[model samples]
Target: MSEQDFLRRLPEAGHSLRRRDRLQHRLHLDFTLLLLLALVAGYGLIVLYSANGQSMDGVQRQGIYFALAFAVMFVTAQVPPHLLRRLAPWAYAAGVALLVLVLVLGIGAKGAQRWLGIAGFRFQPSEVMKLAIPIMIAAYLGRRLMPPSLKHIVVSLALVLLPTVLIMLQPDLGTSLLVASSGLVVLFFAGLSWRYLLVAGVVIVASVWPLWQFVMHDYQKQRVLTLLDPEKDSLGSGWNIIQSKTAIGSGGYSGKGWLEGTQSQLDFLPEGHTDFIIAVLGEEFGFLGVMVLLALYCLIIARGLLIALRAQDSFSRLLAASITFTLFVYVFVNAGMVAGMLPVVGVPLPLVSQGGTAIVTLMAGFGLLMSIATERRRVSR
Candidate 1:
């Protein structure tokens, strides 16, 4: 065109650039991570529609939850890391108090006392501990030196175990394991000694018998037994796993076409929209769809670790790593449980599973990662 036209647009272009800069630097948003999350969430909605019996109502409700979760993430990313560090202990204490209240005054459903109801709204307090435990341990150990002393290790274990035991008493094994894992991940990133890890492994192995005999409820033990030999009770304890495996295997490589899987579409598989949603993806989009979803997860996790490595302080580093790794555990456990490689523990498939509490909690962890990601830029200024 002409020099006059180019000159006329220069001011507007500069204004647009400045607006983008403000979003990145001032809002502390990670656009790459956000884009990847949106893709996954969008993909999840597609699968959830089919999984929930081709119902638009389920899709719309999930859409609402996703919108709310994104808002929570954006708000969480605006909080500075130092303020998060300062507030970590109080959050942990409040989480623990809520968990205790769950045991005392919580409502029970499906044989688990894991939810607290207020004003007709119910939520699982254990979900809060998933974030709080890591932040608490990271804040505590971040203040001390790396390769924490034995005294600090003991204190950290105490911090981890308190909420853990409380959750387990609610008889929710899956959440308790996740809660414990999140806190332990913080300890692992803190440069805890290999010897300590080995000892802990040994102790856990030795305690398995007691856990199974005394600690495990009947249904929990049945899950373990079913995992070993699902055929033992094909029509009973093994039905869910058997059906899930059938749905996944029938999809072949390229899937049976969306909303066409007999197992899910015919209602042969139970809980198709919740914990077993991945099976629906496998049955419809085939193995390729599952792989693509996992690839997105890998990208998001890589971004989180990159942020952790570049964090300005120990708290940010440890907390970021712990949050990211715990996400990995969630995906791993849910996929394994569905594939019959692990016992069914009711862990949802990250963003794929249709649930409000888990979606919000997972996004909030990513929000903290975003804050940690932009922390150096804030500090350098």
Candidate 2:
């Protein structure tokens, strides 16, 4: 009675598995990574609602950004890694051209000329460099040997610094540093020698003085001075950090309860929805909420590293690792600045910060990671 039914069901089960495989192959999605990203983005929307004074408007806008960002990720994942490698140099060239254009005819706001406007739309060229630099370096080095020779290293550094110097001229220090780091991460992943790294570290240490004296603007230097002694001018340049620290400390371990923090609600904490959003999370949901968000980030990063490790080619490995670690740097800088451990640099909290460009750029990076994650499967098939 059961033999014929079992045989018939076996074919149906096989068909279902085939369909699932086809879908995964077509989409090139890593479901686990996607789910983790969604969780963090959802958590961010919750915090944003409270941070923005319980306003639904900001939350709705951010939700729309997330939707668009996820779609970008999905479409990007569908692109083949080989195709990305092929496109890297062009992308890098275009980004550099845009950076030059920004300096020549960029829009200025709040004493910085960083955005290029066209047809009533404005965007940061530096943001494009964040992804471009890594991809370009990876593509260049991936074609050559591992542990790049001095010539390749020099070439890579040149590639990194050109855009960096341009962005710095725009006087947006945070983005310039981030753009530089993204390219350097590719070099690091390419197995640069320890001697080179040590020398570079020393050079950086030695250059700090000159960088401060000649390269750094007065306001940038002032930020450093403010970091050292925030109390000296608590009512002026120091106000932001002082208020941020106060909000974080007052939250204790369990927070002040969602949307109940006097610091944010009373409007003492400035930029609570943007660069200083972590302070809002600390004040509202407490330290526990911050840790939960970090845990999600750690999971996503681990998945990215796993993908990098599994990649069959050097381009995928280098690009994947660079994207993952660049994300870590973003989180580190934002949290450090907000907590007064580092000078205020306008780096936003990864997925949690309320911003349009950063969210899309970050998700596109995750898309690249997803493509690399699935490349091995496609190759094996």
Candidate 3:
């Protein structure tokens, strides 16, 4: 047969395979999850092209990042869970130590020291904690019985809070919150009690005043105030939100069409290729496009949760669910900031925003989830 004919017959060949054979074929990787990620990443590139005024620079960089992320994911999947479990503490310790190094010898930008630079390369150690904390918590709690006692919960909280405090000292509230939440979600999935959750919620509420008064920087306070009333500083700190909302609202149902968004192309929207990329997407692709993007995200989350449910072990389940919820936090926070529903933070939209650290870190987390899924499939056979 000609190569073209052989290529065309592959689908029929696949259809004729036995059910067990098909299952084995599918076990190479979670193709459903891969398809969803590809759809989102492809759409992101299109939006990024428009966001950058038809410039290819941002898109090229993002494409490279995606390529590297995929490679990392592939490599990560080859490692078994047992090894990952054994290495969890070492990884967590390394992450915490890096965060401390960042505080003492880190590079600073815009009055914040959140990155460590060595030999012309720089990365945020907090990003490492996002994945590391979850692994550490999952490994620690997975060994214990379900519905952990108050003692286990306290130890878990300490595990989470140590890195959180280090990141907070870096004055990176966004990353600190993310790292802390990633660990906390693992605890919740590990069967931490609702009464404890209630008590924690109360403590959070009570600490709000102290956080605002002592922990928050002046600019951070400005961001919160601006969220409450953008008009108060329309020409200053509120400018980004105002322009973002206008761009989103102007796109209507059908959008202004690709590369024609005046708000982004004309430089009215701030951070059009980064944190506020959603506003640019909304401006060029409209509400319908937003819905499509959101649907892709929903599918990814659903698949991740499905993987967690199918996982046979507590560690796998907790790690999978925590990674999924971390993705949720990224989407929710970025969307809320752009929509004027929450104070602006430094979060970039997952898989869509132009960033390297976040993309790589998140993809690695997904890879770990895939490893768990593959392990489950192997054991089932």
Candidate 4:
């Protein structure tokens, strides 16, 4: 296909990404975002390579995943936002149905049963909710004739919470929290009332203690309690937190310098290639390295928000904002969990962690954001 014809796509189809517009803007080629993802993903490759200890397969596969994820990001960027909007409700429904199936036949791994196997492919339904809830809520609020009302806000919250409660039932606390945050962004962007926010806060506080006491599984409660002081149970439930802290604090300023990290090399911190990779970064890269990484993430998210601000339609605006904010939460939660400031939530570091599905999903979200930011539309900016 011709370049313009490729990127600027069909109207009814929603995608308008023509290959010709690939370099229409200077900002699209910014190195900060790529640098951040590369360093983090690079660290995953390093740690996974070592963690394998026997073969380089894990890291190699992850390298392939990174390449594929970036490719998806590129392709999605070429598509238009309206296309994604049309897909939102369908995506949400499919996500929920899949979650229900997981509740029935999900393969239990670690401490939760959240994945479904198809032939040789294994999928996590919770990941779908991460993307779906935001899109669904954004589309709903954006479609309102006027700014959303309390009733509309309540509906939005329900859209967010339904999946949260269901996922929590799977004991997938990490994903459930992420899904909640994703929905919150849409409500916030939709201009929800402060009264609603206050009410939600009160409800949260009222529920937390009871939830902690009764609703949370014993291990889940232990994670929260352990976050306060991992040393109290250093040898038991606190080991992960304590090790993560040690790895971070020991890095000081300039880091131990790649691959030279003793903690990661010794395999003291758990899930080095997955949830705890931030700990690996902290151990090897030190304080300065973290700053660099954070800067990159900030740039990427900021760019996404900028795109949302310029969106020609409310749905596109809300969706873009929610996606950007949720990306922020992913980095924040994972880093917080690894730094011992928060409990280990089993959340992967975006782009950096070694998970395949998360990499693809998050990259796809970025692509959609790029599409929203760049596409020419009928709606006013």
Q: What 10-residue stretch in candidate 2 is worst by lDDT?
A: 17-26
Give the per-residue lDDT digits (tens) of candidate 4, residues 1-381: 997786666652453343323444323332344555566666567656654442477778888888988888777766666777788889999998998999999999877888899998898888878888988988788779556887888788888888898899887888899999999878887776788779878998999889887888998888988998788989989998888888889989988877778877887877777788777777777898778778778877887888788888898888889888988999899888888788888888787777888888898787777667665432333
For model 3, the run of ten residues with the poorest summed lDDT: 20-29
Candidate 2 segments exceeding 4 Å error: 1-22
The alpha-carbon root-mean-square deviation between model 3 and the true structure, to one decimal in Å, is 4.0
Better of 1 and 2 by lDDT: 1
**Residue pairs in candidate 3 whose N, alpha carbon or C atoms collide under 3 angstroms:** none
Error of 4 at 318 (Å): 0.7
TM of each candidate vs. truth: 0.95, 0.94, 0.94, 0.87
The 0-to-1 C-alpha lDDT of every candidate, in the order given, reads 0.93, 0.92, 0.90, 0.79
Error of 3 at 245 (Å): 0.5
On TM-score, the stronger of 1 and 2 is: 1
Tell me model 1's lDDT, rounded to 2 decimals. Answer: 0.93
Error of 1 at 276 (Å): 0.7
TM-score (C-alpha, index-matched) for candidate 1: 0.95
Candidate 1 residue-wise lDDT, 78-131, digit = tens: 899999999998999999999999999999999989898878877888999999
Stretches of candidate 4 exceeding 4 Å from the true structure: 1-55, 377-381
Which runs in model 1 stand beyond 4 Å of their true positions? 1-22
RMSD per model, one decimal: 2.8, 2.8, 4.0, 7.2
Point out the higher-scoring one by TM-score: 2 or 4.
2
lDDT of 2: 0.92
